[model samples]
Target: MSSRRRLGARWRRHRPLRTRLAVAASAAVALVAVGVCTAAFFVIRYELYHQLDLNLTQSATLVIQQHRGEAPGVLAGECRFQSAPACAQVVPADPAKDPGKGYLLPVSPPVRQVAVGARNGYFTNITLPSGEPARMFTQRIGLQDKSLQVALRSDAVRKGVGQAAGLLSGVGAAGVLLAAALGYWVSRTGLAPVARLTATAEHIAATRDPSHRIELPPGPPDKEDEVTRLAASFNTMLGELEQSVTAQRRLVADASHELRTPLTALRTNAELLARADRLTPAQRDRASAALGRQIREVSVLVNDLIDLARDEEPTPLLEEVRLAPLLAHTVDTARTHWPATPFELDLSDASATLPGVPARLARLISNLLDNAAKFSPAGAPVEVVLLAGELTVRDHGPGIAPADLPHVFDRFYRAEQARALPGSGLGLAMARQIARAHGADLTAHQAPGGGALFRLTLPSEGGPG
Candidate 1:
């Protein structure tokens, strides 16, 4: 089949809601209409035939009564003609003796039984000798060997019933059509809100903007329907989408700004290396070291950006994290890198096991230690203390300015005095992200020793801090 034809067939198999509802309404109305119409037609036919039977029975009785006072065999003559009240038959009566009189219709064997007093009189359908349909009534003349039968033409009765049937059929057809039309109209009226919802969804898809919302009719909540709840849910989803898009745009802009300095330095180092043949031995070595340092800075910034990108999710797969042992190993590694800065640890009651991603917890602790060591003066002590689930890292270096405290954990934020430092600004941001992921909190303030102090408060195994 052609594509369009196949699609049409599929749609027919699963027709729309309105179509099915309309069809159901129409079917119900049709069933009722059919029953009523059939009953009415049969009733009308019965009434028409009943009048014809009464006419035949009455005409026959009146004729028999009129001849009662006469001689026994002297039957009425007018009933023998077609123009009389009814065509009649009188058995055993020869019109030859009563010359110039119209001949009467002959009676059958069943009517002869009435003449012999063998059977009761009854009515029956018959045909006249003139090829006309009729109804006949037969009965015996009292105490005589003769019977009287009367008939009336039935063409008018049949014609009346036919006319009534035609009228009822027309009414039934019109009722069915009207019912189908009304059913469709009612369905359309009820589904108006669904139509509007479909249009709004299509508009959003075409424009790629989630800023628009569905408006609702003003009413009490008790009167509200499922469609109203659906509209509210759709509006909420749009709000979330807009916020996510805004955050993504801001991240991209901030990352570009932070990357500019290192990229420029790398470009300059590349140019210098292109002319390495003209530089002195010491100068070439220094240039090579500078180049490697710039590369390392760029790599660290990229890695930190990746870590912050996963900031929206909580820690995965909660596992027992031995805080004290993880801390000891990380600090030992930090001492190797920052040999000029002495480290002191006071881990008296810090051996508590917490539920978290072990690797993420290690990264959070590392960011804190690295930040403290980088800001401290040469050979100054970076004191690390942990008791229970709280940790404090105090450094004897220039403390953060009060004005910059609130923005310290913001991505790409740098203090005025710290802009000369050789580190990416995402360190504190990544630390805050991981802390939040593990249901903990990290904050920075001035220590009593006139240095920057970073404090981390961790939650219990399954609870928030």
Candidate 2:
């Protein structure tokens, strides 16, 4: 069970991006380096061994020339030697005849025997006369009149080559260790800027401060490096986020300021109306009505503020709602409130359905109609049309100037000439918030017929068109 758990944990670790990348990079570099080093090491060893074999063949030829014409065929065990310990000790001066050829045998204790076969040369390791490790090489020669064979013991050369290989292996291991260390350090150095950027971004997220930006290290201004470009992009995002957050905070503060004034007025008007016994009935009624109207206006503004703030929370409550009936109710309410203005409704389908927040969606429609009625000339027609999930409200009044259109939804941004108008300048902003909450879209434009037109598009679930 413990082994199974360990395997499961390993699988989980292998699934992550950073772990996988590091493992793959390290394994690939190590494998390639080791493979190339091993190949080169073996190639050099093979070539050195081959050269040693060639030297052995040359030595055999020289020995044959020195012993030429001495014997047609001599047994290897009967050969005598006086000097040249390295040459005479390993190979007999004569060789025994075998299969029409003579093969040399070493008479020394370094090797018990040696026979030069007719095949390729090879080395055989054995104990020497001194009881030490030794190797023998055999070479055969066919002369014009007699065939000769020689054997050589090269214990020193074998030991030297073996030591060289061992040393090379040790060096290779050290090199692999050094390379791994250097590669890790280089990787860290190359990714240090990325790490810094990631750390800064994490700090900003924890603090919820969009003003925090990464400080780039001093270097040559190379924009081509990915790390440098990423740092620059992160800084740019912070700037934009700072501006957007500042704007939102300002909007909320301004909205609060706008609400405070209307609330103060409503409270004052209500207080005055409370002392109604001292005034005539007409005066009392007039004050009460004014207070009521002001209270209603204040209520609407507060609701608008709530609507605007709701946009900060993600995942609004959604429901499938019929569009035509909601529009009908909104228009009816508008007609009742502004009886002086003629209201018209032209819906393309009687049962158009869409996914949205029902209450916010209704409030958006109502706000558009209210805004149109307020701006339209008295007794003028306020046209309301719904076609293909798009609702357009147009008022036959002095349309908004093109320059002011862009700032229409800005909270409390009343036009210079329209500051005295009834609205606190948050209606359009509220309408836009509700539209966004429902995953729909809203825009304002000047109607071709010389009036302000507001178009509200309820996007399909497929996405915005």
Top candidate on TM-score is 2
lDDT of 1 at 101: 44
Error of 2 at 242 (Å): 2.7
Shift in Å, residue 295, candidate 2: 3.7
Report the number of the highest-lDDT candidate: 1
- Number of backbone clashes in candidate 2: 10
Instruction: Give the C-alpha lDDT of model 1.
Output: 0.79
Query: lDDT (0-100) at residue 281 of candidate 2?
Result: 92
Error of 1 at 311 (Å): 4.9
Question: lDDT tens digits, residues 126-196, model 1?
Answer: 76667666767787777775667777777777787898889989888988998898889867876666766
Every candidate's lDDT? 0.79, 0.69
Candidate 1: which stretches are off by over 4 Å? 1-9, 13-197, 218-224, 310-319, 335-344, 373-385, 392-408, 415-418, 436-459, 463-465
TM-score of each: 0.59, 0.67
After superposing candidate 2, which stretches have Cα over 4 Å from the reference? 1-39, 53-122, 126-134, 138-150, 153-185, 202-209, 215-244, 270-292, 312-322, 348-353, 387-389, 437-439, 458-465
Candidate 2 local lDDT, 113-229, one digit each (tens): 222332444555445444444334554344332333443455555665687677777777776776676566656766777777888889888998888878787778764588788
